[model samples]
Target: MPIHEKSLIRKENLVENESLVIDGVDVSGHWSTFITGRSLTDYNDDMQDEIAALPGGENIHRCWQCGSCTNACTVNAVNPEFNPRYWIYLIRLGMEEELLRDKDIIWQCVSCNKCTYACPRDVVPEGVMKATAHWLELKGHTPKSPSTEFDEEFSGQVIKTGKIEESRVIMNFFRRTEQPLAQPWLVALIKGLAFRFPVFYLMRMGMAVVRRPRTRNWAKSRRAINEYVQEVEAANRAAVGAKGGH
Candidate 1:
């Protein structure tokens, strides 16, 4: 469906004449308002396909502009500009330029899944939002979000050793994100754990940290998982025509 919502129209695109006369009839103020015509020349025909290639974006083709997703979106409730339905409409039409207008806020999805539940076509609107955010990052339109950074750290730990060290993951994430390790909450939590845990348990935790233990016989599984991850990364880059690493 074509976008007819006045709120969706960009402010610059809406023209208003305080004093105007058309065909010998005075049409002033809001009566003289007109929306500027838009002509798109930089459409990326492969946008929808590229998004579909990513995880959680496979069902984008099922969207029918039902508007249910936006209605149920948690972020949209607070910020109307965060409209999933409109973004999906732009994506389906390959309106890359239009989609980029909201690049900054697209990653604000809270992943509440309300949109997914409200979508009648099983479009999984929440997933589409995530995929769109990923696309923006991959396309160099936006920086990596904090959540993405944390996900990388967490996933890297699991993939490397087939197990994760919570303290290591948090520290690495904070380091990568340039966050200081001495936050008040973190210090308090560490102190609480140190005092509450038994002496032997604390010692064991310290030993695990120093040793960086891995799952038994995890080398072979690590290799297989690494190969699969590489393959998927290659596919994702090929799909979006992204060059170099994010």
Candidate 2:
């Protein structure tokens, strides 16, 4: 327990520098050299601004990737590579090509909002995920999402009709699927069991979106939204630059 004895013990454990020893493994006198290269540090400025422009993406600056978001996600338990913490880090770093290639996973996120609930900074990882999906589509990555298909079909219906027709959207959506007839049979089963419901399902959960119809001053709202998006993007670029420099 004396100082010199402890020093002797430490010396006994020490290996020649870079001798490939870890945890008592004697990898010394190795014939080969293994080069484990680190990733090149990058500055991904574009993603910050673009993501901040999304519905809940404005708060991305607050994130400090504690891995809590990924831990809180049910999907992460199923998809090992789908780490929410790493995804945000990638966006903040401006790894555009990687993100585009990763669009499939990004698009597949169920938007369960579990990550948002766990985020200490209120970074809203769920919204950032959606923002990433949109960003992927903007980069010319074709979206392979049922949600994307639903959006396209629903929009077509809305523009064609003044109101959203639930039956029509459901029918059109399933018709576009591989087994078009499966839905009608499923609907019949649901109705037979009295389980079929409408948009009011969300309303019962207190979500205002499904409960009420929205109206907008399109001309004014459009201009205002565009300006806000521009400002957030500028701020995000500045933040990313500052962080990268540090």
Candidate 3:
């Protein structure tokens, strides 16, 4: 028998004997490979309902496993393990343990919306990816992901100033994630851009970092938005059984 997901198999389950005899015939090497049998009884029957209650997960029930989302997913093209269709199937079936195997990479979705556009059932797989990542964090299955920290940093700036300073957002994100500002790849990219467009690059950086940008008379709008954001956060927490506020 072939396993649909080899990752789900434990290493100890595999048995291999180089020299063996069965029924007076030699059976070794590839033929000697055998997998131990086991049963899963710990299924979270409510997992699907819990995920569906979260934002962006509402349409999960609409999926028919057509696989269009995975076919059009940009991330899936580069990483075969990033299969949105498979994850959706696992979620619908309440295969919580199986889904957790890919938790670390679920947040890697770039929100390109290609999956959503190609989905015949309008599953909005991009949204489901976000929702799943959030669910993982909220349920304490995993710590707050780097993507979540970056999003909070970026959104906080936008909510407060009615705009965002790109440099500030990046710096804040790096700080929260405890990453060095002078990362090799980032430094190289910046150097390349500066070399190609010295004047424009320096001017843009100066504006984004030195002077900064803010909306005029945005205090009132900011207050209103902040209040709304708090309400939404509380509602989400209640739905997921998390604390009322961040």
Clashes in predicted model 2: 2
Ranking by lDDT: 1, 3, 2
Relative to the unseen true structure, what is the C-alpha lDDT of residue 181 in candidate 1, on a scale of 0 to 100? 94
lDDT of each: 0.89, 0.66, 0.87
Greater-TM-score candidate between 2 and 3: 3
lDDT per residue, candidate 3, 131-159, as tens digits?
89988888888888998999999999998
Worst 10 residues of 3 by lDDT: 1-10
Error of 1 at 37 (Å): 2.5
As for TM-score, the candidate ahead, 1 or 2, is 1
Give each model a TM-score.
0.83, 0.58, 0.83
Predicted candidate 1 versus true structure: per-residue lDDT over 208-234, tens digit per residue: 789996898888998999999898888
Query: Model 1: clashing residue pairs?
Result: none
For residue 196, what is the lDDT in candidate 1?
85
What TM-score does model 2 achieve against the real structure? 0.58
Model 1 / residue 164 / CA error / Å: 1.1
Model 3 regions lying over 4 Å from their true place:
1-34, 189-210, 244-246
CA shift at 90, candidate 2, in angstroms?
Answer: 0.6
Tell me which residue pairs clash in candidate 3: none
Q: Could you tell me the TM-score of candidate 3?
A: 0.83
